[model samples]
Target: MELTADQDDELRALTTSSEVSAAVGTRARIVLWHAEGRMKKDIAVLAGVSRPTVDLWLGRYAADGAAGLFATKPGGPREQVSADVRSHVLALTRVTPPAETGLSHWSTRTMADYVTRTTGTPISHHWVANLWREHGLKPQKQGTFKLSKDPAFADKVADIVGLYLDPPGSAVVLSLDEKTQIQALDRTQPLLPIEFDRSEQRTHDYVRHGTTNLFAALNVGTGEVVGDCVPSRNGPAFLAFLKKAVAPHAGREIHVVLDNLSTHTTPDVKAWLAANPNVHFHFTPTGSSWLNQIETWFGIITRQAIRRGTFASVQVLVRTIRAYITSWNTDPRPFQWTATADEILAKVRLTQLNIKKLVANNTK
Candidate 1:
């Protein structure tokens, strides 16, 4: 192997630079030596590094060329926990109630305890912190899950979400979902924002006024969201909300994308759908409400308007939410959702294969 001018420059930069460490220099030297047709052990001795390091770097250079050498993470030592243990911890963490480890919901302390007691291998709390940070795992103050018993879950979801991805020739695509709990509370102190003289924060404890439900219908293509606040968001109320959300564009064939909640497909809703053949309802799969565009809008509302605000009552919350919606619509843009159905199905299929392989390996 003969060194190209680019390879020579990179090798010279590695040894003479202030940016990278000696280990990186070792890698660079291996690159230079291997490029000059030198053997791995000979390169190791000349570079004053181990033979395997030279061998590994040479192999990497052969596989990916110069970019692979400097791509190593320049950080502290990685965790000592095995991949199996890390997978086990994540699997357990995803489970709800989390009472097996004796906490209402998972906390860092709870996770640390489970790692120590269940595996019979005591791990440091600092290691627990490092693990969560490394994995982008954290405990939210409030997180919830929905369990649906809808029979027509998958097909309905595919149809509804499909409209957003691949819409009809000339029709509006609306992804609708009900966000049931909108708490109205006047906090002990006002929420503090991070700006100059904006850092004065609020107390978590607040005066409970009431709660409201926001029935949202978002037009994916048009970036239009229309919603209403109601005291409840069950079957009857949802039907009424639907009547309002759909009535504006009556007598036209419009696609309504909704989640697989039992109340969403009640006999009343079925009768309504029958009455309005032009208004078709598409449902997202169970535990797949994230597929809805209105869900994306809801997340923005949570972060921007609701989570930190202190509303005096349900009416106040409604007013604030509506105002925020109006403000958002002023410069509305349709969200660009890029995940393909193939990618999702591939992930599910891969997980299934991994589970099967794990079982087979365990049995063996």
Candidate 2:
């Protein structure tokens, strides 16, 4: 293949320019490579396309020049959905389905059926789905949010986040929490072992063998955990766990990040804090226990060990938990905190503003 200087420059520009579509760029590269005396098979390998496709594009280019390399929209013209019909679909999608329909939310099929019957448009569910996608509407999905009611939410958040991002020198920072009522369950029948093509299975029913509480303290600096399985979750149990957790770090400042639980602030806990002058508590904002790092560890343990375990007794469950903790400490990796307090507060402020706007619109 041979090209004029003008054709070569145009082809090079098409391949290099960011404004050109990827398909166009690829097509241009194929032609340029062919002009450079590369084999059709080599071009096929480099361009990630079949030799047949390379031949087709080369044929198009030879027939129509640079204009032929561009792709024309595929398929016939779409059925024209009128502006009124589009507006109607969008408006209904923004609201809950009518009470008479007995639907809490709208699905593509239900919305399509309703629109077809009401407007006599005979719209297909697929069409309704495509229209919804074009408008960025997803009535099937939902999310959850909660605004903290604590008066000192900002200060508490700043305190905890500061500890995470920059801990005090020579001080121990621990995220402490209790996983309460961990039941020891055993399946009534023996678990069916997994086969080559099947998953392991167990009976849906189980025998409950009592419950225990776990108090875990996650070391922020090293990702190590100090844990205890106690019979109950009370101020006494928490105090005992705290003493055990901080025993190794005696004579150094200890910062414990915990939630605002009643037991956490009980008289016994207050007395223990008063007695231990080096120990300090940094409570997360009310109703924001998710801020505690130990909660993440709890989730990990539940998913990995507790949820599927067939424990014959609470003792077995506790031992399993202890073994898991020991294994974790053998190679502990700290969860890195990236978001700054300012970034978090800014997002919360934006959410609050949006809520206010929604409330005002609803009132109107």
Candidate 3:
């Protein structure tokens, strides 16, 4: 069986190419051997197959070149799950289960059970799971979402995002927040220092040396942080930190973005804001402390300074926190906001719509 030049080159390329499937590569070799005048028995021995397999491929190549090799029929039944059943399962996954179903989210077993019960089709959980994989559906997992119910959500988001993206000329934008109840914990046993092949380890139990609140203000332009450990997260502590935080940028207009904490809206805080007209307060929407950039700074301090520290006393904890803040300000990089107020509002509205649908379905 002599092959055309194009067919010969194609078979050779398929045999050599790394991406060619094992079955296709073996067939190509068999065809090449037949073209080279090797007997079917010899080709089968060289290709690690029975003589009939070599004869089959040689006949296919003689008849249709490379195209004949891929023309084999599928070996199994064409249908397992019917089209209607697949559509029904997909529909069930896309919506919340009714209250009578007693489920907040659908699992593979539960979905299979529900489908079998509703449609009289006995489908296995594994099959349901495989269907989900094929369709990119994950009914078992749920992502957290919060849509602000605050009436001033739009205005607050605008105010904070505006200060981040385009601050007033020559004004300082500061993100302020408090990390409360940071326990000064000492490990029950001394930590095992990291070795050549082992990681550093610490005991699960610890001695509590009391807790402190860390009040911080991050300058958006310079990324410098002004902060101190306080005894409480109350009106007094916040006011004291406010005085220190605003002192550096005294002559310039200072816009502070903070969460809607009770201490931030107290009578004393309001009076202080009134007295200091140059210092303005912009509150983030309720339950949305993630909007405040200072929280990122707090996360850094927690991971680097406090999370793994062995502080025997509250004073040591306070000192360690102060030292970290001072070290951070040496080479601070500011946090920049990428999402606009409009984008945020659009997402919140979409989430709210989805949640409303879920609630309605739950009620039904």
Candidate 4:
């Protein structure tokens, strides 16, 4: 292990410097010891390593200088699974299993079995799981989305977004919607309250009393809600709610943002709208109820009031809902719409393009 002046200096520096790794420093020290005319057995004992390790590093330095000492090679044998097998596995994950396969989604065991049966290659389910994880594929889970196809989508979006960004002078902008079929479900047994070291529990079974429809009007500017519970959600029920809900702000111009439900557009409601000249209705685009702010309020009530509540009857449920609305109005905070029309339209266009490309690929 004859060393150049530079190689000797570098090895000395590595042995003393804190920056170099312990493994590399050990190897450097081993070579330096060999250069000092020490036996491989002596160097191994001094460095707390085996005689073979000392010989290995000394030979590496002799062959490739400092570069050889630091070069790393993969230690294990070649992969048992071929490249074609991995490619076939990945491709299968991205497609639906054939009907005859009797699979809804590809589990590790099912995919491993299918691969071995179809391709005559033996593989384990653990190997399949590891490969899928490495490639960031999750065939068992899915997400959801809705695409709006209304012809007047652009105009409807502009109308709703404008009301949120800028409302008419001396007017109230209200986002109105109905949460229907709220069930009054009483558990068969009493709920167990949370204890010191245990979680709350409830019975799996319940007694269904009945259901009710909640008609809610959210003042976009103030975040205050005018809400009422009705037995049904129809044109007549909606008109009745509107008359009572907006009676307080009678003289002022009212701008209401609502979804494009059939009841909202019926001739009876349209006639009532025409007669009320001061009240204006802005319809959100089809399949885009998220644009209506009242839907946000509905989600809050469902989670906080109805979902976990134990109501013996529909009357109790309605009373509980009214109490939540009253409390909400006490400290109302306006919901802000941040995205501009251009930003929204750009996102929609990109999603549409992606969906079209996917459809085209699937058809081919």
Candidate maximizing lDDT: 2
Q: Top TM-score: which candidate number?
A: 1
lDDT of 2 by residue, 203-293 (tens): 1358999999999999998999999999989888888898899998999999999997888898998998999999999999987776789
Poorest 10 consecutive residues by lDDT, candidate 2? 194-203
lDDT of 1 by residue, 14-81 (tens): 65555557566557766765654567777766667788877777776654444446544468786588
> Residue 361 CA error for candidate 1 (Å)?
8.7
RMSDs, each prediction?
16.7, 17.1, 18.6, 21.1
- Deviation (Å) of 169 in candidate 1: 1.3
lDDT of 3: 0.75
- On residues 105-140, what C-alpha lDDT tens digit does candidate 3 reach at each position? 665656888888866778866677667767766543
In the predicted model 2, the residue pairs found to clash are none
Off by over 4 Å in 1: 1-79, 87-108, 132-157, 190-204, 352-364
Task: In angstroms, give how far residue 36 of model 4 lies from its true place.
Answer: 73
* Candidate closer to the true structure by lDDT (higher is better), 1 or 3: 3
